[model samples]
Target: MTNNTQNGFFKLTKFEFTAIAIIMISPLLFSWSMYFQGLLIIVMLWIILGLSWNLMAGYTGQVSFGHAAFFGIGAYAAALPYFHWRISPWWGLITGPIVAVAFGYFLGKLVFKLKGPYFALGTLASGEILRIIFGEEELITNGHNGIFYMTTWTSKLPYFYIAAALAIFSILIIRKIIQSKLGFYFLSIREDQDAAEALGIDTVKYKNLSLAISAAMAGVAGAFYMIYMGFIDPEVVFALHNISIITILVGIIGGVGTIWGPAVGAIVMIFIQELFRSSLFGLGPEWLSRLHSLVFGALVVLIILYMAGGIVGDWPIIANKIKSWKNKTEGQS
Candidate 1:
């Protein structure tokens, strides 16, 4: 609506362009240090997950609380083939998304009839059911004992590059989607479903498509996650809590409807968590580790209360204030 054609990649605003440039050059700048590179990789993975969730809950207003279901399904889908059939991870990478998309399609169909909080609760329930199934299905999921991926000598560098590439690609895909015809439909549906339907938009079809895409992207992230951790368990893979935490944090902190907001939120939240873990744990404080969640929870509450628009949303207001001050100073001078 605002002539976004002029806002292409090369034409990005200064803030956006600078961020992209930094990401593009990070591998080269940090290649000498494995610690930084590893941190970057983990951050990239979170970015992928956050972006996937943002597409569904942020843009489409579907508010799915069960993304971990797709995440776990993809991890298992990839791991099962490698463990039992001796299939290459290359194949698993492709198949994982297919499986996740199919599952997500079914889930969207079942839950789209509900709205708002009920839909969120339904998805949460669905995720919990899947987690229980994975834990109890000993023959398939190894019954919480988990499977360990054989380690390789390629080190974490390759993984870092791969994760970074995937993050960038996923962002690009989301940007495209947000700018497309379908994005308008999504926005319409999010604002008012009945009004959107009155306009002849197929709300159900678009919602399902959004869910499918979100699940597929999440599945891709999960596939890489197994490779990165080299181990998987029902608790880590299928936990409903993890899904809610990541989704809510990313969406709230990043400015939910924006394309790159989730990536920004993921980087900030993960860095904060890492800093707390490192600094607090090194002090040998018993309660610090336990208090980490409390701290994060408090931060979330404050943000929701005082900064509901999130980091990106508040940024422009801050910038405008700064600019006003600068103009007044210049006039006085």
Candidate 2:
């Protein structure tokens, strides 16, 4: 990594800090409706997931298509105890990441052997296999019947606060990791595994370490989802398109390999999602909501074509274009 990249790893500008402060105090500042609060909570969850995916695929150059495997397992880690022994699902907040890291460790052993698209395919299959396994293992997992429980809080306030804290925590942890030597190792691996290994770096070991951290973060998000939503099923947690693909999009659209890119991506994604889901808050026709998936896909295509570096990644280019347009308009006037 260049000196600028290393320095930029954890350094937050005033604008970014202001945004963080606004999110931290959002509930206190505005007496928002429960619906809006719910949206905020979901956005925070995605922020965590996005950051998790970014750490592995962005920093470490290991593009995983099976994040849902960690996510679903984290959720199930919490749900199983609740289903079998009537233990509080809240305990999943602790066990979720542990189990996720364990699974990631073993999975890394198998998939890390492959490189590039093959690795991606391996991960994609792992998630699907877990989904099937969980669905079939009725004796332990309750099979496809799923797990249901009444949520602890009636209001969304507590959940929002918890989610916000987790998001902040995720940001801090990732920033710290990126500033350390491990972060450099990850960058080296991403740049070229062979070169990193030639320089005496243990590529496999570091890759596993990166995956562990990523898995833990995803696991925590999944556990939080289970407790807040008060329900979980194989399909909901391990859905290939919803969890895995959306996680990838979050990384890509936010500016993969950039520290704050995922955060920006999460906000954009959730806003777009809710806007369409509500059919422009009922202003547009109901059928407009049905096109959200199509719109999202098209947006991704546009981003890849024109904004390959992502919103944050390509901010300099975007700013320059805006500046030129302003100057041209002034000259014309």
Candidate 3:
């Protein structure tokens, strides 16, 4: 079992290296143009969001349903500076993460005592509260009116490159955490907090650290989002639905606890959404919008039931099993 796990890890590492290389070189190989650049930015944003959520929910086994609160906080942090003081968003990149980490620390302190479903409910309630506050505070957040970002000389390509760099950076951070001692601590805590504590692991500290890191990454993504869209509203940034959808779908479709799982899940979900929006629009039915959600929801359910290990996890297992079978057959022959 140890050997098999090690081999699996090696194979996954190689595959990740290759995939990242391909992604880095994609723009040079294919002309993405300007219009496609925006799409890439969106994909990269989702990748960052998915990866950050995976770090918290996947590895730590702390299912936070309210990550969108940090995301919204980051977006507002960036936008508020630019709108009020005419400051560059570059500064917000630093401030956003700081604010998010602080908020995450508070959240961890508040809810780490709770276990399982209670923790999830706490996060969900916190998210709802943030949404309500943002929506009601018209004087600060502009309420339902939203805030328009000031235009800059930076074009869509810069934003695309920025998003791509952030995605890569996030993946690298996750990969490092997974391979480090901290990862083992997180895994131990996930399996059994009491056992981990008995083994001398500081479960609370590690959990808070993981939460802070995850929130900071999400904040960075949200900060960039404000710059990319040049506008943000409480409805768009602080929406609980967005939080639930991204966290649930990414972790479910991708192999939770694996570095590349959430990223792969984000890519698949985004492509599916785009395909549905493009191809299903004129299918001669007014009810087609419902079909998209229905199909996606069904797919999520099936993935959860059959592929609990996630696409990333199961794909390698199946591939290795086939290979082993083939080798055995050849030996018999």
Each candidate structure's TM-score, on Cα atoms with residue i matched to residue i, is 0.90, 0.95, 0.88
Lowest-lDDT window of 10 residues in candidate 3? Answer: 1-10
**Compared with the true structure, what per-residue lDDT tens digits does model 3 show for residues 1-333?**
113233322344556678877777665554546645566678788888888888888889898888898888888889887777888876768898899899989989998999999999998888788888988988877788887876564567667677888898888777767777888888888888899999999899999999999999989988888888888888788788776566668777888887778888887776676556555646545555556656677778999898898888788776898999999999999
For residues 146-221, could you state the per-residue lDDT of candidate 1 as single tens digits?
Answer: 8788745457777877788888888878877887788888888888899999999999999999998999988888
For this target, which candidate reaches the highest lDDT against the unseen true structure? Answer: 2
- Candidate 2 lDDT, 211-245, residue by residue in tens: 99999999999999999999999999999999999
In candidate 1, how many Å is residue 152 off? 3.3
Each model's lDDT comes to 0.80, 0.92, 0.80
Top candidate (TM-score): 2
How much lDDT does candidate 2 score?
A: 0.92
Colliding pairs, model 1: none
lDDT of 3 at 288: 57
* Candidate 1 least-lDDT 10 residues: 1-10
